[model samples]
Target: MSLERTAVRQRAEAVLRRLAGDQARLREDQWRAIEALVIDRRRVLCVQRTGWGKSAVYFVATALLRERDAAAQRDAAAQRDAAGPAGPTVIVSPLLALMRNQVDAAARAGIRARTINSANLDEWDEITAEIHAGTVDVLLISPERLNNPDFRDGVLPKLAATTGLLVVDEAHCVSDWGHDFRPDYRRLRTFLGKLPERTPVLATTATANARVTQDVAEQLGTEPAAPAAPRPDVLVLRGSLDRESLRLGVLDLPSPAHRLGWLADHLDRLPGSGIIYTLTVAAATETAEFLRSRGWAVAAYTGQAEDADRRAAEQDLLDNKIKALVATSALGMGFDKPDLGFVVHLGAPPSPIAYYQQVGRAGRAVEHAEVLLLPGAEDAAIWRYFASLAFPPEEQVRAVLAVLRTDRPLSTQALEPLVDLRRARLELMLKVLDVDGAVRRVRGGWLATGEPWLYDGARLRRVAAARATEQQAMIEYAATAGCRMRYLRECLDDAEAVDCGRCDRCAEALFTPEVSPTALTVAQTFLGRPGVQIAPKKLWPTGLESVGVPLKGRIAPTEQALPGRAVGRLSDLGWGGRLRGLVGEGTPDGEVPDEVAAAVIEVLKAWAHGDDRWPSRPAGVVAVDSRSHPMLVGSLAERIATVGRLPLLGRVSSAGSAGADGPRGNSAQRVRTLHGTLTVPESLAGALAGLAGPVLLVDDLVDSGWTMTMAARELRRAGAQAVLPLALALAA
Candidate 1:
């Protein structure tokens, strides 16, 4: 109880030792940040490179701050009241993996840390009680939790009033202009303003350009709306954003199969266990499967993986029990394994800033690590697909605002058909609006604030332009002949950008270009042996009745199309690349390629004998009229009919002008777009009027599947016994 300032410093040093053993000592920047937060109570923004001990600053500062508080209270002769809080540190992190790692690390430092996230819903009440009882020393939470109705209105105020330190990990997400911006992070302003005077706030990020740094700094100084509080002057500590340990390189493979072949042969030669990052979940899955088939110990990780599975995979990787985790961006941020020796990107991310953040995960505590980019020709198409899902257009935002009423809460399900955005995008827009005070997500869903919100068109355009610039920068990085590491640093606006002499471009090529013939054959076989089941839609999308469709609840068994087949997915690692050139978002419609035809034949051959085979072979083949891919669909139908020895029935034609153009929309909107657009041709109707066997319905692809659904229904209504749908690819 009589502890002095010097005593607190010694205790901090001891805590650090406990976490990292005798080798633990704070870096100058870490000590500076800790002293500023604990002594000066000033807001600090640390924009250093990854593996720079950013987490250590917060954990050490938390220990010092709490001890400092208790010592002052004791000296003042103020006994702790029953209701007085333990003055815990609240850390708003970006991912569950981050939270898990932080919580475990904190316990090692003798600092009690707990987390409340989607993964621990069953323990929310228990965690809440612990917080109220002043038992938690540090609380880690996801950004999304800050906007929850019960959390925002009921729990946050108490937590803020008692919080001694606020740490914003991955704080670049606070700025709209940041590469990985999230609107939920902007809600931190409200939380910050509610804190007691002079509460220390620390924000840290590994990826931020000069523009993003300034933007986040400004937001760090923003106060909440009412009874304005004084903003704390932020102390910015930006170090050289370079990893001396990384040896960067670019490997431009000619084709997807070759890339997989390269990985199959070379994965064993890469330094140590690290992450193999892919741009999509399907790619991660397919890559992991290929690697496993080739005798590599690996596991696939994505946002779709269960929480327990992710935890197990993370542990396995940490223990060096596996070769690597084939993962998407899901396994990113706060996954700490000091000896992680390499990071290989299957496809380039959209920006050099993102690439820097990802590759930095390697060589944290080692002298050397390998960072390689296997950029694909299809990278641009994948980029464009994700760009489509960015912040909605201004009109779409206004439309969402128009539907929310002050008196009622409408769940996302209830709002889908009423708006054009899909559920994910719709929910994202709502969170952005919620942070802007234009709407609020409540128990059931969301409600309007009746506030006059400006469109900020100019700002949105600036962000859009910035994205395009970043994308071009990434492409340039992939092709640049200069220092690969330096080019990335320059893109991040690092003031200390210099040639990393360790890179392939800086020295001689570090990796060989040749892939073994056996490896290539194996990769091709895995890629070509393709068949993906097109799961049939069962329940109708809610609010379809409001869209003038008069449909809701279960889709009648007869109305639904039977399970179908596709050659592959647009996001698959192997067939995906070739399929993209033929059926990607902007690719012009064309006849099926000979290669694709052969693959389709293989699919048919397998279907005729595979377990999911149809009850009987089709008696006839029919084409679904496609406004975009008519030739492709017609040719596919003719080829299938000829090969299967079935009659070529006439194609179904569009009877109405209605069509859902552009990339796919929400389910209800897609269904509405094609509900009455298709009609059975008189010739096709007559041919199918007495058909007794299933009809093979051919199309270029199935995106929303509404086209196939509608076509199949029309065929059934025309008297076909059953419909069998087949296509070249399933849009990811």
Candidate 2:
């Protein structure tokens, strides 16, 4: 071994001694692996799980490389010759947060290191300059950013020329079998091949099964080092899914207000930190405001929220200023809070993988944690909707392909017409295509550089096959009869398959059957009447007047009078009222014309009645009694109960629907229209009045039954008594 390698080994051994204490010194297999990589100069891939000490492998290897460089300088000095600058090591990470953490750790260890990300451009520039100058020893960057040509041509080539080690952290990203795969990762194969042959490469991750391990090897074009011996003593809890500390219940209500009430009750009862995962920003915002009205400290996080707002909300969560957080998928990744006691899914996650990842955030410290998966008819509808989006029409693909095929570079604006997509949406699709190398951006526009033949032949077939596989995985997750964790493990391969007894099915099977009667009934109803379609308006008591209650004269206000009147009524009735303005219109000052407001409320309360028929209006209806209204308090719970048991409904399209010009899945548009109709804003009341047809009302959540109730009444007044409501989840 070289003198420098020997010195590095000595230092590493000392560090290991300190860490291991009286435990046996490094195992023979470990020693052999280390020596081969450091002294003999070989690449290494350490496939291990969390707490496996994979960090030691690279830490020791870097120490040796540093020592070797030092010894070389000393030898050059003795010979009165100038020594070349030492090569700098590069570490490509998957998450910016992880990279920053590593940088902090290295600094504490007295090692020279720096990180590069969108957050620190000036620092990134300085670090790149230092790497070129041969002064920096370690550089950390996200794999996504490494795909940038400017970084590749300007910074990486210099480091590669020097033949420095390249380490890929969270290396599982290289595998399609892994849960997270960035198309940018595929580009690493070509980039790594460009590096000097002798330069060693090291890949590390906390989790990897056999399939993922093999894929990582293929992506790096190298054989993996012998894995460290399994640490059997490490506790791997495959306990029952029952979290005794968590009180579990499901509700079956027909309105969003009821869902909100359930949330408020939970907040009142628990009064601790929790997370509410919604399917959309509008839902998150509405839920947060509802909770706030109930005097709970709450905040919301979603893609639509400004970055500053998201940061503040996260900070509030960390600081415990807010007892609960309402969010979408945007809040899950990179969030760290050890004391979080609960994770409630207001809607079912898009896939089992997403569900697992979100739930994994809880109980990370092995302390008692709880998770709730709330499902509703609308939630199922949302899932079906997403499935439809995933399985886009072949025509859409053709249109996108045609845009990409333009010989000249085309800007998003120019391409939008061809693809029939808004500029923003077109950009998202283009990004996915770019990551797949199906298109390339040049100058101010995009160019169609993808293989044309591949577009139609075997390559396209392969892409389709992959999508089909993903679809199958989703279906299996939704319909599986066995353990959810095991299913996830089978699908992801990288995740451990051990049963987590905490999931609903597992807990029910192993511990107790806490299934709700309402949910079971709804599920049975759906199963029995698979072909039956009922309109939301028809479900309300007003539509059933022929059966029992009297159908009386109802005046429909003009659309122009709706907003002010609805806002006034809700505010007067103490329903946490706020009129989301259009353009710059302010809230109109006046009691909603009494007849219109009272009529809307009467219809809403009648529909919300738990009894089968509408109650006598003047006597049975209570004016927004926040305390006694089951529709407001138990809305989410009731919806959850009813929807959880319902089987998945097939996809439905919203084409030709009035006011449906926005993005297919925009929550804002859905909420605005649904709420506008529910509140009977004169502007919308007229449109709804005397309208008759089978209509489908889609929303993210059926929280309190109020929104759906009012919507049904408006539809009835409009002459359309058949209105079906579809939502992603019924908040529980």
Model 2 CA deviation exceeding 4 Å by range: 1-64, 77-86, 122-124, 147-149, 170-172, 175-179, 204-214, 222-276, 294-298, 315-325, 332-342, 384-408, 422-425, 428-438, 450-453, 456-732
Assess each prediction's global lDDT (C-alpha) against the native.
0.85, 0.50
> Residue-wise lDDT of candidate 1 within 1-732, one digit each (tens)?
235446656766787888878988877787778777876778899999998889888988888777666665676554453123348999999998899889988988888999988878898899889988877889999899998888878888888898878999999899988878999999898888877777788999999999999988887876632355566799999999889999999898888789899999998889889999999999899999999999999999999989899989999999999999999998878889999999999999999988998998899988999999999887887888788787788888888888896488889988888888887888888888998899988899999999999888899888889999999999899889899888989988898999989899999988976899999998988887878888777787888887789878887777667888999998887788778778766678777788788888888888889988977888898887777777787888888878878899988787553322335578888778777788898999999887878888887778877778778888888888888888888987
* Candidate 1 Cα outliers beyond 4 Å, as residue runs: 1-7, 72-86, 224-230, 657-662, 681-686
Residue-level lDDT tens digits of model 2 in 1-732 = 678657656776765554444452664445555665565555566754333345455555665676667677678663353222257667877655456456655654456777777777778777877777767677777766655657766766566566456777767677655555555666566456556545567777544555567678766663222234221111111112222333222334444444555565555444358788887665676678666765788898887777667778877886889888898877754465656767777656655556655665554444566665554435544554444433234466556777667667776654543444434445555655665667775665677775542334454455446545655565566556676556655555544456566555566632222334553443333222111112222122122232233332342332111110111111110121121111011222232333333333333343436353322211110011111122322232233223333212111112223222223422222333333323333533344343433333433223333344454445445444344443322321
Question: 487 in model 1: Cα distance from truth in Å?
Answer: 2.3
For each candidate, give its TM-score against the true structure: 0.95, 0.57
Compare the candidates by lDDT and give the number of the best one: 1
Clashes (backbone N, CA, C under 3 Å), per candidate, total 0, 49
